[model samples]
Target chain A: MSTAVLGAMYEGIKHIFKHTFTMKYPYQKVLLPKGFRGRHLLYMDKCTGCGICAWICPERCISMVPVTDNKEYPQNPEKRFPQYWYARCCFCHFCTEYCPTGALDYTPDYELAEYDRELLLWSPERLSRPPTNIGEYQSVFHGKDGNQGVTFEPVIKQKSK
Target chain B: MTTEPPSPGISISKTAEPSTLDVSVGPQHPGSGHCRILIRVDGDYIVSADPDIGYVHRGCEKIAEYRNYVSNIPHLERPNIADAIHLNWGYVLPIEELQGVVVPPRGKYISTIAAEMNRIMSHLYGLAIMQGVFSGHTTIFMWAFGDRDLFIELAEMLTGARLTYSFLVPGGPRRDLPFGFEDRLSRLLDYFEKRLVEYDRIFFSNPSVIARAKGIGVLKREDAKKLGVVGPVLRASGVKYDVRKVEPYGAYADLEFDIPTFEEGDSYSRYLIRFEEMKQSVRIIRQALEKIPKGPIARKAPLVAPEGEATGRVESSRGEITYLVMGDNSDKPSRVKIMNGSFRNLIALPFLVRNVHVADMPIIYGSLDYWPVEADR
Candidate 1:
């Protein structure tokens, strides 16, 4: 029993000098993979107002709204676009898969926290705007255990993608 | 008042018997999850334990009737989101059989990878919870959860979601392998392998843990089968039954892995079984990645399935997960019944806890690895 306690303590102390596993969230963030599904980014030009994304959403979070801007999308006569309610969105990205026009895409901006519930709903115009101040951190593996430790090198990027 | 001499080996029923205290251990207890256990105790020893489940029941089967075939994927995986791929496969495989949609060889390989990844994650999560229960060993708990993040990160890289993948569609996986996946996976596997050794030295080999767990809740081989316990609990009781081994599906038929079983049937053995399973999962992942072939990931599936009832089964992280999906020739399924492993294993809970100390309750409970949310669902 005494030996076991001492061994466990040694194991714990061994990690003291090793780098911490957690990312310093607001300051340092994980570098998400290429195909990460985070926040919805809408392309108004290629959308074609089909509402396939709205139809395919299991949560019924996406609704088709009439487009007021005719100058931006001259080809679209349907005068409709998708407005997303983030409150109900499960972020399954099923809509992205079902989108035939390839207009619906996801940006790796997972931080969707807001002060008000009403502000959670994103209009087509709001969804079209790109994400700002995205944090990208490079993961460096150190130590021989393969599990020994990881150090995150924070790489701040201006572009969302 | 003079007391009569205690009967040898047996006690006769009397008009006025010694009263046993009934203590209800939670719907609110942090250790017990959403389910409650009503225990009848004679002093410190439990006389009887009755599990009261269904706190988190959301009528998952009933909800399956309203949604279309594709839409049901996300909802079906909700029962045990940690092992979502297995649940996803259980539901999708039946739908595939009904629709005659054959997943290609590559798709099978990828599914195997994702399933194994989910299994490792699920086992780690269970171990973390079990560690917490075993004398508040917060070190192992933190280590397990921290390492679990590695697998979760891999899952997110592969399937695009952290918790609910919804990656598997009826025909095949929603997406193919991403760039730099194999390299990242191999490194993580090596690290995880080393961590397992550390875990053994710290938690499993700890003297205090063994004293509490060993011979505490011994479910004999006969009793295990009789009680209909499934998963690690069943395996720990010496029944070498794994649905993957019995009926191989997807890439499991082609792959090679051993089903770890223990004869002891104690809480310690159950803990060991999970660790062994995690190691096996790692082996399976390495093999699948090495032997993965080049082919179409998915076959073209129809929007609607035919009118028929088909059953699909898979070895989930917990145990055998079987799905009975009945399609009414519509876009939606007429009925979907999910038989999860946790519910099947719950029958042994009362038997195991009986005659055991109140302090050993958490160890026995955690050994069973019963997820009340999955059971209730």
Candidate 2:
């Protein structure tokens, strides 16, 4: 009986010294894959107003509108397009995949927790721009010379302490 | 494969024979899709199994005669929802090759990456179903399905659709990655890797589960060769014949990952192989995400409406999905024939199940991850 009690006590003490596998994720961010799916960015300038993305959407989250960029250039048919609210985005990367000029793109930021719905509504400004010093191909369809508008994805640099 | 079913069999004397039972598993079985098997059993063991297929048959080939080439894309997607990228590429590849559509390097990379993710989910679904059969734990199914949402969400963000995404055209994919896609995908990958450990803890490492699976329904490499079972099952049986390896598609040649194998060919070996495959899939997806070149998701469809017949053979979740499409230069397909792996497995089930006890039926059947609707089609 004494040996059994001592064994239990020893096991408990040993357990206390063991390392924990769980990480405090919310408090401290975990390492992410280099290419993860996140939110959508629609580059209004590069958008051709083609409805293929919307038509191909399985979830029916994407929609097109006649909103004006700065409400200027009313006569330019190409100037008006919809402001995609990515809060409902499925992140299939359809817009980015369908963009003719390589304008639409996917970047590695996936966190979309928000306090308000209004913040989710993004138009041209929300569309991704080319990364610094990356190559860009200028063509109707994203071409071989670094797809029309796709900017180079830089190697992920760890945050400095 | 079973002796061609002996035509006009002569009956044996009933007075001297033991009693045999007739059991019919349906085109409507909850565990299965559209294939029905009528099994002849003597006491606890199955004697002969007759497979009745075409339950979910939508004559894609017949319909293709009226529709145009562009319209057949959705029809192709109906066969396998788990590995949609493979199907997408399968259909696009022939067109790309034939029409002189040299997709940008970025396009090939995206196809390769997306297909690997789809393959992971497909294999996960296969393993989950097997787990459900061996033990009544649907937890892995829920987990696998839940994680599938991540890939679905990823695909949706990329192509604007979850299941029937027409994102991959002949030239290339439809769009580029969404802004901040990497951040979310990175986090998701971490989450997926973490879940993989949990899967190992709960499903793969469970002793009772292992006992139930270890040596059941084994297929010898020789027999598998004769039967022509594809995908991980054949690989699990010590055969290293993968469509990706045999005929390198998209950017598969460029990516680095192992095609996991096991020589046992038992149910346990298959389960383990699939689990390892999930890990490899993560590796492949990570590589694609990291090295995905900045480029156009797709090239323009080189040949606009044309009369052509193209066979899109893809490696689906089940195994090899052969999509035969014919076009008449219109916007739609002239004919489409979707041949799925589940049908092939269903055909060979009786051969595998012969003399096995009734208790082992679910484990044996579920281990194959046969999708009925796909088979019926």
Candidate 3:
């Protein structure tokens, strides 16, 4: 009985020497792996103004709206583009897959917090531009054998797709 | 002030010796998740435990009726967030049967890997919650959560998302295995195996946990079968009835892994069963990764299905999750019924809590691995 107690205490003390598994947010951020489904990045040039993304959305979060200033394309005369209400979007990336023209893609920018509810809505113009100044730290495993711990390693150069 | 009269067939009586007090443990308490348990206690011993479920009911079945079959994947998986892919598979399996879409061998293999990964993740989540419930040991809770992230990372690499994969579609998974997935998975699994040893030493084999858990809320094998408890809780009672073995689905048919069972039906046995099952899950995953065939992940499935009702059953991290889907000629399903393990296991709660001490409430309740949101849905 005493040995069991001592063994448990020893295990607890052992973890103290091991590196913590937590990420210190803001100062040090772990880089998300490739193909992480996050916010949508729309390619307006590739888009034929098709409403497939809006139609296929499970949450009904995307809607097609008219963009008057866009350059005219032979395939699309309506000049309608998708405007996403991020408040309702589940980020399932079904919209990205079903878009036939390869117009939609997901960026690894998941940190989309806002003080106001209305600011959560991303317009066609906003969705067209990719997120910047993100993802530098890569999660690296520290320790040998079965007693392993996770730590973040900072990347020297920025990653580009 | 006015007092209401008693209803018919009910009598209020003051006992001769001592009064039985009623204690309500949340629809909002930290220990009980989203559901309330009203316990009638005679001094320290509990007379009865009435589980008040449905605190987080979202009417997922009723809502599935309105949405199209393809779009309902996200809504159906919300019931159990930790094991979303299993729920997704259960809902999608019937639709795939109705639509006449046969998943390729590779697709089956991929789905099996994802299911096993989610099983480990779900069990770890359950263990973390169990630690919080019975022992309030933050060490185990934190360690479990931290270790769970490893599997979640592997899952995120395979499927795009971290938590709600929605990776399982009608016919097969949405994506194929990513590059270098096998090597990373093997490394993580090795680390997890070592972590399991630490878990046994620190939490399971700890003297305090053994003292609190052993011989408390003991359910016999006959009583377990009689109560129809599901998942690890049932296996702990030595039932040996797993849906993976009984009606094999996906890649589980080809897999060679044993269903771990314990003769004793106490809380410790239930915890041990889950611990053993995690090891089994690791074994199954490694086998799947090695033997996966090269082929197309999915066969094209139509949005609409023929008029027929089909049921799909898969062993979820909880237990057997069965989905009965009735499809008309339209794009949307006519009716969808999801029967998960949490509600079935909930039947044993009142039965097991009887004649046990009040302190043993968390042990019995947490041991069942009951998720109120899943039960209510």
Candidate 4:
């Protein structure tokens, strides 16, 4: 009984020297993988106003509305684009998958918290902009014990379009 | 004080005993999910327990009727987010059967691997919150949760989302194995195997934990079979019945593993069952990864199914989950019924909590790993 108690204590004490598993969020962030289902990145050139994305969305968050901007979209003759209501979106990315023209793609921009409910809605213009807050820390296991930790490395940012 | 004559509407029973007091143990969050157990206690001992469920029910079955076959995956899986793949797979299998869709051997292997990984993740969650925190061992909770994230990271790499991975569709898995996935998985498994030894020593083998759990809530083999408890709960009671062994699905037929059972049938055995099952899950994943054939991951299945009914079952981390789907020659299913483990195992809750100390209630509840949302759904 004494040995068992001591054994448990020993295991607890051994972990005191190892690196902590948690990250300091806001200051330090773990890098998300390539195909992470976060915010949507809409491509203006590829979209043909098919509305398949709006049709396939389970939450009915996507609505194909006419682009109010004067900018001419030659690809979209009807001038229809998907406007997303982020509050209702479950982030299933079925919209991205079902889009016939591959107009929608995933962006690693998960921080979607807003102070006002109205600001949660993202227009086609807002969805077109690239994510700016992608983190650089990648999780890596090191040492003989295979203790998991994160390492910081600079990432080459790619244009969303 | 003068006793009044009893009215015609109100007749008092002479044999009625009022020694027991009824106490409600939360529709509030009881460590795991929102579930209230109405326990009738006679002094320090509980006389009986009645489970008052449906606090988190989102009507998953009814909602499946309105949504098309594909869209139903997300909400159906929401019932138990920890074991999402199994719930998703269970629902999809019936749909595939109805539509006459058979997944390729490679797709089957990938789905099997994902399911096993999900099983490990789910068990780790049970170990952390259900077993660890309930047992009052905070260390195992932290360690298990921390380790679970590693598997979750790999799951995110495979599927796009983290918890609710709508990875498996009707035909097959959504994505094929990613680049360097096998190597990374093998490395994680190696780390996890080593961590298991430390866990056994610290949490499982700890005298305090053993003392608390060893003899408490002993569900004998006969009682277990009679009550129809499923998964680890059943296995712990020396009943060697697993849906994977009895009715093989996914790549379970191809893989070789053992169903670890103990005769003790106590809370400790229940806890140990999950630990043992995690090891088996690791074995299953390794075999699946090794034997994964080179082919296309998924085939294009039709959006609609013919007018018929089909049933499919999978052994989830909690227990056996069976889904019944009826199609009316439309994109949406007419009727979808789910009979999951938590609800089936809920009968054992009130049965075991009886005649035990009030403090022992949490340990018994946790041992069952009863997710109220899944049960209520």
- Predictions in order: lDDT: 0.86, 0.64, 0.87, 0.88
Tens digits of per-residue lDDT, candidate 2, B119-217, equal 776776676665553467666666576566566667666666556666677777766777866766666677677667667766676665677787888
DockQ value of candidate 1: 0.59
lDDT of 1 by residue, A32-86 (tens): 7766888889888888887788777887999999867646676567768899999
Q: Poorest 10 consecutive residues of model 2 chain B by lDDT?
A: B7-16
The docking category that best describes candidate 3 is medium
Superposed model 4: Cα runs more than 4 Å off: A145-161, B1-17
Please list the Cα RMSD from the true structure of every candidate, rounded to 1 decimal place.
6.2, 11.5, 3.2, 5.0
For lDDT, candidate 3 versus 4, the one ahead is 4
Residue A135 CA displacement from its true place in model 4, Å: 1.2
Give candidate 2's root-mean-square deviation (CA, Å): 11.5
Query: Interface RMSD of candidate 4?
Result: 1.3
Q: Model 3: per-residue lDDT, tens digit, B68-87?
A: 88789998998999899889
Q: Is candidate 1 or candidate 2 better by TM-score?
A: 1
TM-scores for candidates 1 onward, in order: 0.93, 0.67, 0.95, 0.94
Which 10 consecutive positions of candidate 3 chain A have the poorest summed lDDT?
Answer: A139-148
Q: Give the higher-DockQ candidate: 1 or 4.
A: 4
- Candidate 4 to truth, TM: 0.94
| Interface RMSD (Cα, Å) for model 1 | 1.7
Candidate 3 positional error at A16, Å:
1.2
DockQ of each: 0.59, 0.04, 0.74, 0.68
TM-score of candidate 3 relative to the true fold = 0.95
